[model samples]
Target: MNKLQVEAIEHGTVIDHIPAGMGVRILKFFQLTTNGERITVGLNLRSGENGTKDLIKVENTTFTKEQADQLALFASSATINQIANFEVISKYHVELPEAIDEVLACPNSNCITNHQPAKTRFYVKQSDQAPKLKCQYCEKSFNVELFSELN
Candidate 1:
């Protein structure tokens, strides 16, 4: 059988293991379209571990810790691969922080953080299957899906 391959990048980041169909969301989260970075997205690709997964390659860009953490809200299983000079320099799984500030918007409209200039803060509740978040200001509990509603 023949195999397909994505062109490798010289220097940038490769995000692998994203949940299938989430490549566009990741791109939106990073605001890559407006920035003019060369981006390639593969969706619903075969994965031995996940059955199906998505991948994103951003040329000439590296993700920051905060950005990676934000990505975890949606693509928890994603891994970051740093490439330099056509070589894999580093690779690591994205880790969600115990608490994230301003990375997510509180879904509750009455929450103080949403009404004012205050940054939204959340205390992450860990889980093996799915994580939940509790708003620090309103004491509201929500799932990561709220990320799609972020302002």
Candidate 2:
């Protein structure tokens, strides 16, 4: 028996276990495609634990801890793998951040971040359904999905 494989990168980051259907949103949100890096994306792949999952491999790019943590909004079960020389050097799961600033644009059009020079800020509120992010500018709580547009 033989199994197909995706080519491994020499040095980069691999995001695994993304909830199926969120991979494209993440790619667009992070502007990964605009950076000119080779990105391989697998969607709706069979998963032992989650039944289905998405995976992303970006060559020559490493995501910071803060960036990885932000991914928890879309994929709480996701894990980041730092690869070097085609080997995984480090691996860890993404954690939801307490607060995030200057990354996601507030969904509210009337928010100060959209009108003035104030940076966008949100306080994370984890819930059983979905994590809500309360915009610091307008004081409105919105589910993380609404803040996917990058600032």
Candidate 3:
């Protein structure tokens, strides 16, 4: 091992097992573009199990269930851990819901979730073997592959 990896944070949330290309997307979801917190992002890491992985370590950021659920939609196999004093206080395996909310704004022009004043929510429909979704409020369905964070 190169031992180039950074040291762990004293306290915060760690998102591990993100898919190779989705770490930055998740970071954007958390609005982690720039901040004073000691956020560490490591991608294409070696995973004993998966052979490759990605990780996000956010220092002092209290992740809400809603936020976690958003990432879970893509990183369903990810692991969320609460750390304190460089020790894991607790751990959670992200379980993407059958429906996701606010994490996305439906691209369908007529979908109710697309209204600026509306709360964007969608039914996950499927998360494995070809992810898909359907709007909870407007009954619109689309490919999760089409839902992406704006740059």
Candidate 4:
């Protein structure tokens, strides 16, 4: 029998344990739009003789807290593996923050976050609390913001 092998990278972040369908969404959410050769993603891969899983390899890529937080929200179960010299160096666990920016859109009709050329803002809100966001411009409730796109 013949066997094929793949070499591990010297350094990079490998995201594993992503829920079945969430792998693709994570790639797009980060806007991996540049078509960079450094990024790699494998979906529905067999895992340790068990069920299928997903994996993402970002070559020489180190994520900021914000980026990791964003990933957590989408796939809380995902595990981050730091690889160096083709071996696991560190294992990172993902945690979802209470809020995520540029992710959700304000539901308010007059919310500036929804207008052209505006950067979206996400905030933690309470059921009894008044407006959510302190508008940078209009100083009104941008509180209605909700996740605009699931992907």
**Selected candidate, larger TM-score, 1 vs 4:** 1
Computed on alpha carbons, the lDDT of every model, listed in order, comes to: 0.82, 0.88, 0.76, 0.64
Candidate 2 regions with alpha-carbon error over 4 angstroms = 148-151
Q: Give the least accurate 10-residue stretch of model 1, judged by summed lDDT.
A: 142-151
Off by over 4 Å in 1: 1-4, 127-129, 148-151
- Mind sharing the TM-score for model 3? 0.80
Off by over 4 Å in 3: 1-4, 34-36, 127-130, 148-151
TM-score of each: 0.83, 0.91, 0.80, 0.66
Which residue pairs clash within candidate 2?
A: none
List the candidate numbers ranked by lDDT, top first. 2, 1, 3, 4
The root-mean-square deviation over C-alpha atoms between each candidate and the true structure, in angstroms, is: 2.5, 1.7, 2.9, 6.3
- Output the better candidate (1/3) by TM-score: 1
RMSD of 3: 2.9
Kindly list the per-residue Cα lDDT of model 2 for residues 1-151, writing each as its tens digit.
4443366789999999998899998888777888898999988988886498899999999999998998998899999999999999999999999999888898888888887888788999999977899998799999876766663
lDDT tens digits, residue span 25-62, model 3 = 77765567566787899989877865778899999876
**lDDT by residue (tens digit), candidate 4, 68-140:** 7567655677888888888888887877555656655556667665667676656433345322443444554
